[model samples]
Target: MKPAEAYILNQPEPFKSMLMHLQILIEGTFPDVDLQFKWKIPFYYLNDKPFCYLNPSKKKGYVDVVFWVSAHLTKYNEYLISENRKVVKSLRYFKLEDINEEILLTVLDEAHQLKDKGFYKRS
Candidate 1:
């Protein structure tokens, strides 16, 4: 198994389940995306560019599905968390039930559209 997959599989429960669910959702939505282990986390790349990453913060008790081109995302701003970061935003989930499929999908689609436009370009 790839290190990225292994990382997800090795996470503690609640986080493990959430990461697995998110991996399915993201891979299911974009078949061409590449899952790579980067920065010691699971990062997804589209067309060799940073797409999104799955970060399970055990200490924080949450998983962050972080998008690189957050500056261009127009829809679902209410659902994306920046946490004072400038170049990226994320959808944070504490448990399995917190993964809102509809909002997640929409935000993902929005971010996917911005992939070719560079990382921090304004929409």
Candidate 2:
């Protein structure tokens, strides 16, 4: 298995389940995305550019679906968490049930479009 897939499979309960579900949703939505192990997490890339990552914070009791070029995202801002960081935003979930499939899908679609337009190239 790839390191990215192994990372998800190795996570403990709740986190493990959440990551798996997220993995399915992301991969299902973007069949062309590349799943790589980066920064010790599962990072998804579209057209060789960073798209988003799955970060299961066991200590924090939540998984974050982090988007790379969040500054350009215009939709679903209410669902994203910045945590004072710049250039990135994330949809956080404490449990599988906490995931809103519609919101996640829409945010992902928006992010995907941004990537297609080379938004990641901007400062």
Candidate 3:
């Protein structure tokens, strides 16, 4: 198994289950995504650019699904956790039951669509 997979599999409960579910959802939504272990976390890339990442915040007891180009997600702004950052936004999940399939899929789809548009590209 890849180190990224092992990282999720080794996480403590709630986070482990949540991360597993998210990985499945992301992969299912974007079959072409490149999953890699970067910065010691699971990073998803699209069109050879950074798309998003799955981070397990064990200390905070939640998993953060961070978007690399969150600024362009104007339609989903209400759903993001900016944390005062300039370029990224995150969706936090404290429990497995909190996963919203429709919203997550929509956000993923929109982000994927924007991958080649350069809206989220680094300067």
Candidate 4:
């Protein structure tokens, strides 16, 4: 298995299940994305550019879905949780059932579209 897949499988209990579900959603949402293991986490890239990453924050008791260019995603502020971060923003999930699928999908889709359209390059 790839290191990224292994990382998700190694997670314990509910976190493992949550990561698996999230992996499915991400793959389904961006079928062309490339999954790579970097900085000990799963990072997804689009057309060779950083897009998003997944982390099961065991210490924080939540999973973080981090968007690389979140600062530009002000229109979706209600769905983000950066917590004083400068560039990236994230959505946190404490439980599998707590995931807002529709919002998450929308945010991910927007992020992908933004990067694809060269929004990051314009900055």
lDDT (tens digit, per residue) of candidate 2 on 1-123: 999999999999999999999999999988978999999999998877899999888888999999998888889999899999888999999999999999999999998888657664434
lDDT per residue for candidate 3 within 35-93, as digits (tens), equals: 99999999998766789999899888989999988877865678889888888998889
Worst 10 residues of 4 by lDDT: 114-123
Global lDDT of each candidate: 0.90, 0.91, 0.88, 0.86
Q: Write the per-residue lDDT of candidate 4 for residues 1-123, one digit (tens) a residue.
A: 989999999999789988899899999878988899999999998777788999778988999999998866755688698788888899899999988888888888888778656864433
Off by over 4 Å in 4: 119-123
Candidate 1 local lDDT, 1-123, one digit each (tens): 999999999988999899999999999998878899999999998888788999888898999999988888888899899999989999999999999999999998988877555542334
Per-residue lDDT for 65 in model 3?
93
TM-score of 3: 0.92
What global local distance difference test value does model 4 have? Answer: 0.86
Residue 53 alpha-carbon offset, candidate 4, angstroms: 0.4
Q: Cα deviation in Å at residue 62, candidate 2?
A: 0.3
Q: Name the weakest run of 10 consecutive residues (lDDT summed) in model 2.
A: 114-123
Candidate 4 local lDDT, residue 95: 94
Considering every candidate listed, which one attains the maximal TM-score? 2
Q: What is the lDDT of residue 82 in candidate 3?
A: 87
What TM-score would candidate 2 get against the native? 0.94
C-alpha root-mean-square deviation, each candidate: 3.2, 2.1, 2.2, 2.3
